[model samples]
Target chain A: GAGVSQTPSNKVTEKGKYVELRCDPISGHTALYWYRQSLGQGPEFLIYFQGTGAADDSGLPNDRFFAVRPEGSVSTLKIQRTERGDSAVYLCASSLELAGGGNTQYFGPGTRLTVL
Target chain B: AQSVSQHNHHVILSEAASLELGCNYSYGGTVNLFWYVQYPGQHLQLLLKYFSGDPLVKGIKGFEAEFIKSKFSFNLRKPSVQWSDTAEYFCAVSGYSGAGSYQLTFGKGTKLSVIP
Candidate 1:
């Protein structure tokens, strides 16, 4: 793909329900990241992966949030017992590598998750 | 913990007016800085980034940012603003680790309303 892509552009789920958001990174991108953005706020880091391993997951809010990049290409973010506070836009981004040589991250359209 | 701060939460300007958005970060080690923009109903896009060398970096749409290492600041500026520049601007900083784990920390964001 030319750019990162996410599934379920909009999701409205009841509180306490389980939900999963998916991300498909750009082709040949070796690094993938997940972020969360609330209304009127900027995006916050969630998780980062290099290849198939999660290089950094410290940004996860709590145990209720988990993300996995099994094949280093497609990733899934799972939330257990979602709460109203979880309502926000989930963004996904990918870069060629994280070597710091000006690896520009291309972002997806984002999945707007609304917990009702 | 490293954090990014944006001075203004909201700003209003007329077309052709000069624009400036303040960004500051707190990090002791080497880091990369970036600016991202989000138009209404659109995804986040890269405005500019600073990795090393030049303190002043130019970006698309006549936007530029200056990275001041001593002050830990990377401020975005535009000589002339246009109505199309009305959007949310975010300042981000990514910590550099040897393991290639790059996680970006973003400010709360500043909304710019450019009146035509």
Candidate 2:
């Protein structure tokens, strides 16, 4: 893809429901990241991937939030037993270079999740 | 934990007025700094970045930012503001330790509304 693409731009789920968000990164990019943004706030880091392995998952708030980039091109963020407090926009980004260096991270349109 | 701080939560200015948004970060080692902008109904986009070059780095839309290591600041500026410049700006930083340890820490964005 020419740019990062996210699926189901808006999602409304009931509390305790499980939801999955997907991201398709640009071709040949080696780094992928996930972030969460609450209203009137900046995006908060959730996870990062270099190739197929998750380089960092320290940002995941708890055991309920998980992400995977198995193919190194597409990634999925899964929230198990979602809570109303989890209502926010989930953003995905990708960079051409791997982690540990300075590189531009291109952002996606983001998935707005509304936990009702 | 590393963190970024944006001083102004909101700023309003008339067209052609000078604009500045303050950003500061706290980290113990070398860091990479960046500024990103998000317009209404649009995704986040890069404004400028400061890795290891000149203290002042120019970016798209006639915006520039100065990285002051002593103060741990990466303040963004524009000589004159335009209505098109109305957007939310964010400051982000990443630690430059080693591979798989890179992640961005972002500040709460500053909402800039430039009236024409």
Candidate 3:
């Protein structure tokens, strides 16, 4: 079975520009999450979606970061006014619903974003 | 809020050497723990996870982790590591949250280098 995948494996944009990174979760997965990993740091949570609605986005550093998951399968992370600090690997993951019990999350290859 | 700590930033060892990586997490509520590995130019992949039951959990590639609730630790270990085991390892923890059930808190990560 196909695993989680990300598009535009590498993206470069100028400062103050806007960028959108896309993610496709595994089939039948109902929970999606977005994380950002900076140099020398672990991946930080950005947002989480359960089904079509965003359950939490508290990890977003500022107003410039936003993400959406439509139809519960595809998710897009949008960054506005991109800054050099925003350059990092964006990771996406998915897992089965959490209501019943714990489930392992499957991670995508991640999209590397560079802000010049 | 929750956080994870990896004691070592980098570790180097020869092939067939024993390997151990320490991880500690801080969360007041029930928690789930995970260890993820990322190879060179590859995405993060799950190595193991502990939700409940026995504290000792075994995973793929001859990896295993012991979850100690009192000490709040989940340590990864391998009796004999190969060169192919060289990679970055991450410790993550998920706890109950009103925003969502599984938003993860990750550690800075430990990079392991296995000499051939």
The number of the candidate with the highest DockQ is 3
Clashes of each: 0, 0, 0
What does the interface RMSD come to for each candidate?
Answer: 1.7, 1.6, 1.2
lDDT rank, highest first?
A: 3, 2, 1
Best by lDDT: 3
- Could you tell me how far off, in angstroms, the CA of residue A41 lies in candidate 1 after the best superposition? 1.6
Give model 2's docking category: medium
Candidate 3's residue-wise lDDT over B1-116, tens digit each? 79899999999999999999999999998898999999998889999999999999999999999999999999999999999999999999988677765877899999999999
Task: Provide per-model DockQ scores.
Answer: 0.70, 0.73, 0.79
Clashing pairs in model 2, backbone N/Cα/C closer than 3 A: none
Per-candidate TM equals 0.95, 0.96, 0.97
Cα lDDT tens digits, model 3, A3-98, are 999999999999999999999999999999899999999999888899999888888999999998878789999999999999999999999986
Task: Name the TM-score of chain A in model 3.
Answer: 0.96
Give the CA lDDT, 0 to 100, for residue A40 in model 3.
Answer: 97
lDDT of 2 at A34: 96
Runs in model 1 lying further than 4 Å from the true structure: B97-100
Q: Looking at model 2 chain A, report the run of 10 residues with the lowest lDDT sum.
A: A95-104
